[model samples]
Each structure stands twice: as structure tokens, then as C-alpha cells.
Target chain A: MNNIALGRYLPLNTIINKMDPRSKILILLVMMITVFLPAGFIGYVPILIFIATALYFSKLKLTYALRALKPMIWMFIFLLVINVLVMRTGTLLISWGWFKVYSDAFSQTAYIIIRLTLMIILCTVLTATTKPLDLTLGIEKLLKPFEKIGLPAHVIAMMISIALRFIPTLIDETNRIMNAQASRGVDLENGTMTEKIRAVLSLIVPLFVSAFDRADQLADAMEARGYDPSATRTRYKVLKMTNVDYFAMAFALVVFATDLVLCWI
Target chain B: MEAIELEHLSFSYDGQTDVLKDISLTIPKGSYTAIVGHNGSGKSTLAKLIIGLLEPKSGTIKVLGQTLTDHNLKAVRDHVGIVFQNPDNQFIGSTVADDIAFGLENHCVPTKDMQRIIEESAAKVSMSDYLNAEPTNLSGGQKQRVAIAGILAMSPEIIIFDESTSMLDPQGKASVNEQIRKLNEAKNITILSITHDMEEAAQASNVVVLDQGTIAAIGTPADVFQNDALMSRLRLDLPFGLKAAKAFQAHGIEIDAVMNNAQLVEALCQLK
Candidate 1:
């Protein structure tokens, strides 16, 4: 119960929570572009500021954003070291028989790591601020225009939304089935590679069978309601572009433009 | 005037012998009908046939004046909803809200209206608070509520309960039965229940006993349960009270009893 309570959507009642998901996604896209735009410290400082500001406005904790970046910390450090020490473009600080470090290496490493950290945190902020269902709806609305290009945007978004909803459910089911199998003497989390594989296969069979049975019942329910997949559908909450949305987009665009100017200068 | 009419229905799966053989039955409109039989009595098969989930080899089903056929199966299906036996089998959505919305979404209900309907349906089954709660997290009783919510969302004219309450504990079964009874009164949805519980069968307005896919007995539950010889051959557990009363009668004790334990006590006390 506590595990469910923790993972369940907070349903935060705030301005950020109410904003159109499409707008949030568009803002996230702009932030992704910002990461690639910064050329030096001048351009980078503003982006770091922008990320902080966005995080604040979204009412998401900075620590939660930072926590999400922990797993990738190792990769970030690896890339920083590789990019700074191996690329010989500036004056050398030290030269050994096989390895050399440039004078600008420290600053370059710092900048790269910061950018990588900011990118991960920024992305996490967007997701944590928005519900998966809302984000899916937002994506659908944003991609509505792309239907002209032969993209089944609605279908894709529905798939994504439903997929997200199923993730926790699947996890819960896998856990339940694991418990049932464990009671029957299946050791899933330990053993040799082959033994583990066998355990997992045994677990998967019952899960799939249950899933199939659910599908058939769902299909029955669908047919019983005159459900037609290839039909026009309406949304539950109408997504509208608001003033906050424009403000968000503008903030992202300004960072991108500043980054471009710094690169040129 | 029958609400559901089945004629000479026969069924077999994968070149096997007939699971249901030459079955004919009629369920009157607004009637609470129970189909009872022991395991392998083919009662569940009839439940599937009525909803058009399985096609018959040689038979026809008429639901609400519309013939159950491939061409109109969609419309027929829309008017007839079914709650299956296994609570787990009927749940397709991760959450109760999502599950209820699954049916409405399929029918292309506007999202705003769909949400309201989903909420109302969940409330009808006393699952409104757990609307966004995951189905896997629910108890057996709670999952059944979600399943009922899904059926309610469809607003079908007829609802078939295919041994839905068998998996529940007694308390859970009683609660679900209460809800079903209330819904039949408030919504007027025709209910065709397939059950082996003698108590449940006793409560229904009509009872059908299936033996080898044929209609062995069909009447008010009280009307059909009086025959013990047939129930024995079908492998059904005899209703305890009825058997007790019969036992007393065999011992030369004249006793009158109804379905209640209290009534049985009074009748037994009157025994000299």
C-alpha cells in the first residue's frame, strides 16, 4: 500500500500542473536544443540559470531532479575525461610519455559535465512535473498536424499513453506472479545464467496467459460498447495554449539564441 | 414474449464432441434468470453463446427482438454485456478508471463525457475512490467491482454474469449480489446468471439447469431445485436446508420450510 501510495500521481493542484502538456513538451524540446547550443562558459551560465528557473516554476524539487542524474554520473565523468584529455586543441599543461593535458582541460571538463548534468535534470523535471497521461495527450495534440504527412499520430499517442499506464500495472503483476512462483520454489533473482533464464521463462508464461485472457475480455467489453478504433475521438481535457505556455517557449528560445550568439562571437 | 430466445444451439471446439447439444431456452424480459449446473454441465457455454462470444454450430439467439448473427453481432453485442467468472480474466486496464474507459473509448465516447460516465460507473460499484487505483492492487472483491464498472459503463440492455461471484468469499459474494439486485431494479438490465450456488439459484426469478449442453430444467429457482435426482446426476451439491427438510420428512416428521435457516428451525421445532 505504501509502495502504491508513493508511486501514484501526486495530482498537484498548481498552475504548472494545469498547463497544457503540449506546451510543456515543446519547452522540453527547446531545453534539449539548449544543451547542444552552448559553446563556452558565457553561453553555458545562462542555460544553467534557465534550467534552475524552470525547475522552480514547475514546483519540482531540485534534489529530485539531481537524484535522477545519479545513475548517469559515471557516464558523464567518462565523457568529460575523454573529451578534455584526448582532444589536443589548446596549450599543453602537462605532457607524459603517452598522455597530455591541455591548460584549458579543467574548464572544458567542468563545462561538459555541467551541461550533461543540466540536460538530465531538465528532462527529469519535465517528466516529474507532468503526468504520463497528460504528456501523452500533449504529444497527440502537438502531433495532430503531422497526420497530413501520413503519420498516425493519434494511434501512436494512444499507444504511448496506454503503454505508460500499463508500466506500473505490469510491474505489479510481475511482482505478484513472482511471489506466487516463489512460493512454488522458483528462484528468480539468483542462480546461474541458464537457471535464471529458466526461472524468468516460467514466470513469463503465466503473465502472458493472464494478459491474453485480459485482452479477450477487454475485446469483449470494447465490442459491447460499439468501439471502433478507426474513428475520430474527442479528448477528455481540451488542451489550450495559454500565456504561461508562451512564456515557457520564449524562455527556451532566448537561451537557444544566446547560445548561438556566444558560439558565433 | 422472450427477451432472449435460443433454439437448437450446438457447439464444439476444435473438432471435438459437442460441448452443448441441441439446447433451446427462453429468458423473458425483466426476469432475473439463473443457469445452474455442476462442473462440465455446459452451463458456461450457454452464457457465452447468449453474448455472441462463441458461434453455435446450429442455432440462433434473439436478444431484445434482434437476431444474434454475424451481420448484427456488433449491435447485439452492444446491447448485451457480460461479466466473466475469473475477476482477473475481465480486467484489461491497469487502473479501474482506465478499465471502464476502455469500453467507452472503443465506442468513441467523447473524452469529457467518458470521464463522467467512468466516474459514475465506478461509483455505482462503490469503486469511485479507487478510480485511478491499479487493478492488480485490488482484492478479489475490489477487482470484481472494477469488472462490474466496465460492464456498467457500456450501458448494455442485458448483462450476463458467467459465474462471476464463484471466486469471492461469502461476504464478497453477498455484496456483489446486492449490487446486482439493485442495478436490476434501478437500471432494468436483464440479468442471466450462470451459477452453481444453490443459495444464489434460489434467489433468482428463473433458474435453468443445464446437463450436457441441453436444458435439463428451466423455471423459477424454487421450481427447478425441488428435483434432487437431476442435480445428483449433474454432480451438483444439494442445497443444505432442502436436503435437511427432506431428511426429516424421511424420518416421518412432517415439516414445512422455506429457504431461510430461521424458518427451518421453526419447522423442525414443530416436529413432534
Candidate 2:
């Protein structure tokens, strides 16, 4: 259940959550680009404000979003420290033996850290509020223009959606297979590296066999129901561009414009 | 009209020994027929052959009056649908609605008509409430029901349950069987159930016992069950109710060949 809550939908009926998935996707894409714009305070302030407002209306817990960023905090710090240590253009603030810390490096590292943290938070908010199916539909809708260029947009979207749907099921299967192996005296823990690798090998083979079997059955089932990849298909839910979606897209554009202007001035 | 006709069909996975050999059978329209056998008894191989998933090594298969061939395979598929054994693997859509709509999409069903068909099929399987629910969260039986609904939405003339209930618990199996029965009765759809469960086979209108790539017996359930030696030689276990009835008869008590536990219980209650 906890595993499901990681990136699962919360069903909150807020405006941000109710916005069209395509708009939310477009907003996220533009917001990502805005985060990389060069600015000291102006660029980040607007982004921070936008994200905060979206999160507030999205009704997603701040802590849950933060938890998604927890694993990357160490990497962020490592990059910050590396940037400070490697740059030699700015004035040296401190020297310890051969290592030096520069004034500009401190500001640069701070910028890197804040940009990354905000980017993660914003992306997390997009995923937390939108249903996985809606996300797939949104992505397919975005890819529609490329379909004329032989993109196979629907196939790609279906693959992604099916992969996302099976993740939890695969996790459970892995656990079940691990327990079955454990009962058969395959020690998973308290082992040498080679032994651990061997244990993983044992688990992998059965998991792969089951996955392949599933794929075979899925193919047969799809074929029996008249599924053909090359055939043009009708979609059940046609995405409508609502007023709320228009508003959200406009807001994203305004923020993007401001970020670009901030970088220029 | 014959819903399905297999004439002297032979199939071999490899070029060597046959998985199914010289099989001939005819299923009447609107009939519930069960093919019972042990694992590797070529029951599933027979089903795959009928569905045009596998070509016979020799002979011909006619489904719904159309002769199945590589050239006309797609046309044959439009009239027949199958729900395979593994419920988890067979669900192609992310959600219940999407899964059932998958078939409709393939058929190029108009958007408005698709919704009504989806709703009707879901209602048939009692899965109307779970339209938006993810397939991963569903139980084995519920997933199978969703799979059935997917088939039902296509409105195929014949629906094949290829050991679809073998993976579920007793309750799950019971509910799935009940839904299948309802589909056959309410819609007059022909059903071909491939299973090893004798109890399920006993309830069917006809039972085809397959052994060593050939039909050992094909008749009404009572007529087929009367051939005790052949069934025993095929290593097929009799249904529990029939076994209990036989056991009572051996002790100088008269009990007919009841098909289920409830019938057996009621017969025992009637004793003076």
C-alpha cells in the first residue's frame, strides 16, 4: 500500500488536479525549461511561487513530494561541493592545503541546489496529482502531431502505460518468487557478494520465465480480441480542451516569459 | 448449425510426435461444451487450433460456418473470442474500462456506441462499478471477469474459456462460473470451456475427454461418466459428489450419480 502511494493519484478535486492532463504536461515541460534560465533571484522566485500555488491547490502533501527528493539530496550536495572545489575564476574564500573554496562557487553551488530541488518538487507534483492513465493519454495527445511522420505514437504510449501498470504487480511477483526461493533454502541475506549474486541469478530466471509466459499469454489474448498494431483505432475518451486547461496553459506561458526576461535583464 | 467443427485435425509442436492427432468433433450452436484432460493432454492445443492461433498439421477447422485459414484468419477471429488461463497476463488495458474498450477499438467501433457496449459487458460480468479501477489491483476472478467483459463487448458468436477459472480460489471460481453460465443463458452464446475440473465438466451440456492427443469420449455428462474404466484409465478423477454417491452405493445405499455437493447432501437427507 505504501509502495502504491509513492507516485499514485490522490483523487483531490482541486483546480490544479482538475486541469487537463495535456495542460499539466505542457506546464511541467515549460516549468522545467524555466528552471534552467540564468538568474540570481528573479527566475527562481516566480517558479517557487508558481509551484507553491500549484501544490497548495493540488492538495498533495509537501512531505510526500519531499520524500521523492530525499534519495537525491546526497547527490545534490555532492554536485554542490564539486562545483565549489573545481572552479578557480572567483576569489578564494578559504584554502586548506591544496583545496580552495571560491566566492562565486558558493553562489553557483547554491543556484544548482535550489534549481534541482525545485525541479524535483514540481515534477513530483505533476505525477502525484495526475492519474497514470491520464498521463499516458496526455503523452499520446502531445505525440499526435508526430504521428504523420511515422512515429507510432499510440503504440509507444500503450507500451509506457502497460509498463507503468505492471510495475506494482511485478514487484509483488518478485516478492513471491523470493519467498518461494527462500523456503527452498536460497539465502537472500547474510551472504558473500558472489553468493548474493548467485541468489539474485536464481530469482531472476524464474521471474523472467513468468514474465515471458505472461507476454505470450497477453499476445494471444490481444490477438484473439482482434488487436492489430497497424490498424487505426478509436479512442474511448476524447480529451477536450476546457477553460481551466486554457487558463493553466496561459499561466505556464506567463511564467516562462518572465523567466526568459529575467535572464536577459 | 455447428458452432465449431474440427475434422480429422492433427497438430504437432515439433515435427516429431503429435500434440493433437486425428481429432474430429462438432459443437452445436448455443451449447456449453467442456473439454477435460490432464496437463499436456492437448486440450489447450485443441483450443488454440479452433481459435486459429495455431494451424492444424492436417485437416480443417470450421468455426461459425467459416473455414479457418491463414488467409481468412482475421475474419474467423471476429466471430470468436477467448479468455486465457492467466487473468493477470490477459488484461491488456491499464484500467477496467480501457481493457474492455480495447476490443471495441480494434473493431473500429464508434465512440458513442463503444460506451454502451462497454457498460453492458461490464454489467454482464458485474464489473460495472470497477470501470475505472486499475487491473493490477483486481483479484484473479475479477480480472478474469474483466477479461470476459472484454470478449463480451465484441459480441462474438462463440466465447472460449481456456481454463480461465483454474487459477482462482473456490469463491473466485464459483463467481466466474456463475457469470459464464449467465452469459450462455442470457445471450444464448456458445461456450467452449477447456478445463481439468470434472465438476465443471459435469455441469456442461457435453463433455469431451481428451487423452494422448485423441478424443477418448464425447457425450452428455451422465453418458460420459458411465464409462468408469475409460475415465480411470485416462487418470481423470470423478467429481466429489459422484465419488461420494458411489461410496454410499458400495455400502448397500442407493444414490444416483449427483453432480455437486448440494445434490449429494440433499440425497443423503432424503434417506429414511
Candidate 3:
């Protein structure tokens, strides 16, 4: 559980890591749209090359991207099976009296898997290169414009940052509760369905109680520190877009445009 | 001017039963005062009231000579900071640097000066090296230190510790206590520590014992600790030094009532 690396930052001094998180998040968004542009297998050559170049420059291995995909492997397989069975369009590849396989099904599923794999890898790259706090700042900056539409951007950003801050603490609390329950003659593993549910409820009840208690204390602490949501607060760590950030954003936009043009062709 | 003054302050979660009733106290500026009490004795409630986290049911609370009102609540909070008992909950930042930055950001400190202020504050708490470290990776002591650094960044004149060291280990408690002492003596910042540990309270310039939400006794540690009946009735133990002195007196050795271990040690050494 501790080794979950989906959004873990890799502390390195590479250029990709130095790029502004705003630019990286924007690039990820552009790439996500580009991946689904119906830009056939031939068009994916440049996209894959771009990703490989990114991974190389970011000082990250292909395994990091593959690791992000590992948890979703079963879901991908399930999707492939469902698509293969449901879609009845293209050239027939195999038939067994109502059981049939078609070329289009394989091709479509391959495109979907490729698209999903690229999206996941792109997301992984963004997270791996950017610190979580910086990512939150970038998000807050992006959401600032939406605040004009009555959106509580600062509050949302604070919530995200606080939630990120407490993730490890809550994880530890969960483990502690589990251990406490285990010691009290509660069999969490090999119990009957009802017993297992009861065991989980015991863990959840204490966790929820503690979480509420933590929230209450946190509110007091924030208040004591002079936090007023409506007041104007300055940024301590301001995000500045540098030359590298601009170049990266341009490169991602060009790649996406090229992919769209390829689809039209 | 006093750092904090409470007059006729009373509070209750439900209006029927009072948690704190007609409590009045004054904490002089630059003084270290410890509010000690058993569970549900309203020590924490008093701290919260002084910091304006909770409004008293009826009474006036003044901080830095200014009465606490809804209009000036933010201003009052700016001059007063709190380090809560649960280090994990009070830590509002992903990293030590960011945590210190939280209070400064709220105060609208200029970006140009934030880095310098944060570094100075972290240095004060001896957490300069761990600025980039995540709170999760830190021990309870380190987290409390970072929390102190957070309050220090704002340069609050008075800091209220709502049992901040209660959840820490003995070493952690000692380090935090040492920091609190330094802040009071060196920086001349007023300190109000609400603690269950009598030994910690003994080190304060003054100790206020609360029993059932009323002030049972208030004086210097030595003066208060001398009243054995009051200490027992309040379910408060004597400081380690005082307790040890009493035991020595029982065995035909006479020693004056000492407030802390160092005083007791010195007295024992001088007896020869």
C-alpha cells in the first residue's frame, strides 16, 4: 500500500521536472484530447515518440508509466473482452456457431487500449515530474478564472491541498484501527460475510469518528492562524511560467494539431 | 497591558449546563502562565475563548488590551496564535515550509519577504533543514515544532498551547517545552500553556489551577504547590521535585518545597 506510485513525484533536476506544472497539466489535457482524435495507428507514431522523449528527458523509466497501468490491467482486459463480444462490424476473423470474432473488434479495442495507455502514461508523467503542492497551485491558478462565475476556487484549492496533506495520516490511522481491531479477537480475514462486514464497520466507525475529530481540531487551528475565506490572501509560492514552460506548451499544442490534421487526412 | 483578560466569561455547549462559569483571569504580557486541570475542567475551553475560536456565552474577552469583537476578531487572531494538541490535525501544509507559509499567506505577507520569514521561523524552531520534508515523514515532535514555526512566522505576541505537548512522547514534550520557555524568556512573547502535566506547569512563571471550570488556585508554582489540600482536591499531583522533597522529608531528611527537578537537585547538593 505504501508503494503506490501513481502520483508520487520523482525528485530530480531534469528539464521536464523544472517545467511549470501549469504547462504540464495543460499539455496533459491537450494530449488527452489528441489521443482520441481517430488518428489511426500511423498517426500514433509521433505521439509515442513524443511520450518516449518526454520520459527520457524527465529522467523517468518506462516502468513508471507501466506501473501506473498495472492496477487497471484487469479493467482493460475486461473492456477488451466486452468490446470483442459486443461489436459485430468488420471482417470476420473466426466463427464457431454464434461465437464469432471480427477484425474491427480487434482494431477498435487496440485503439481504445492504446488511447487509454497513452492517457494514463501522460497523466503519470505529469504527476511524476511535478510536486503535489505545485500541482495544486497550478490547478488553483487555472481555476481562478472560474471564480468569476461564483466558483469558490481558493476554497476548492485549500480542500485539495488539505486532503492531500492528510492522506498519509489517514492511511496510518486506518492501519492503526485495523491492528487494534485485530488484537481484540476480531477476525478480519477469514470471517463469515456478516462477520467480515461487522469487522469492517468497526474499523470504519472509529475512522469516521477520528476523521470528524480531526476536522474539528483543524478548523480551530485554521481559525487561530487567522484564516478568513472571504479575505484576500497572498500567495507565498507563486507560479511563474518560464521559457521552458512556454516551449513545452507550444510543443504539446503542435503535436496535438498534427494529430488532428492526420485524422482529417 | 495584559496579553489577555477575561471577565465574567461563561460558556456552555448547550445553554442549560455551563462548561465554564464566571471565569475571570488576566495573563500579563511577557509572562508564562500554565492553565492546568483534569479532563473536562475547561482548560482547553479557556484557551479557545482567549483565541476567539469560541465566543463566551456572556462576558468580555480582551487580547492585547483590545476587546474581542466580531469586527476585530481577525485582528485579534493575528496577534494570537495557537498550537493545538493534535499535531497532525493542526498541520495545514504538505511540507514544513508550506505549513509556515499558511499563516503568512493568510496575513497577506508579501511574496518577496515570505521566504525569508519562513526560513527565520523554521530556524527558530530548529526545523530549517526539514523545510522541504513532508509532515507525514516527520515525527510528532518535528510536526509540533513545525506548527510552532507556523505560529512564529506570524510573529504573534501571545501564543496559546492547547495541550500541544500532551500527545507527544517524553522527549518530544521536553523539546517543545524548552522551545516554549525560550520563546517566553528570550523573545518575551507571552505564553499560555494548557496542560495536564504538572511538571510542565511547574516550569511556568504562574500556574492557574482550574477545578470544574472555576479557578481553584492561581499563583506562582511554589505558592500553589504548597497547598496540599488544594492539589489533592483538584486531583493534581505535585511536581516531581516537590513530590520527591516530600518523600525525603518523610524519611528524616528536610528539604524545602522545590518547584522543579533542577531546584530539588541543587537543594540536595547544598545540604552537604
For every model shown, the clashing-pair count is 2, 0, 0
Top candidate when judged by DockQ against the true structure: 3
Model 3 misses residue A208 by how many Å?
0.7
Q: Which stretches of candidate 2 lie over 4 Å from their true place?
A: A1-6, A95-98, B261-272
Please report the TM-score between candidate 3 and the true structure.
0.97
Residue pairs in collision within model 1? A227-B106, A227-B107
Share of reference contacts kept by candidate 3? 0.94
Off by over 4 Å in 1: A1-9, A80-86, A102-112, A189-191, B88-101, B108-123, B128-138, B240-254, B260-272
Docking class of predicted structure 2: medium
- C-alpha positional error of residue B83 in candidate 3 after TM-score superposition, expressed in Å: 1.1
**Ranking 1 against 3 by TM-score, winner:** 3
DockQ of 2: 0.76
Cα RMSD of all models vs. native, in order, equals: 3.5, 2.0, 1.5
Per-residue lDDT for A1-265 in model 2, tens only?
A: 3365456677787777767889889989999988998866668888888888888888877787788777788887887778877888788899999988888887887888788788878888888788888899999999999999999989998888878877877888999999999999999887999999999999999999988887788788888888888888898877778888888778888888998988879
The alpha-carbon lDDT assigned to residue A25 of candidate 1 equals 87
lDDT (0 to 1) per candidate? 0.76, 0.87, 0.90
lDDT of 2 by residue, B163-240 (tens): 999999998998988888887888889999998777788778999999889999999988888788887788788888
Candidate 3: lDDT of B253?
A: 94
**Candidate 1 docking quality: incorrect, acceptable, medium or high:** acceptable
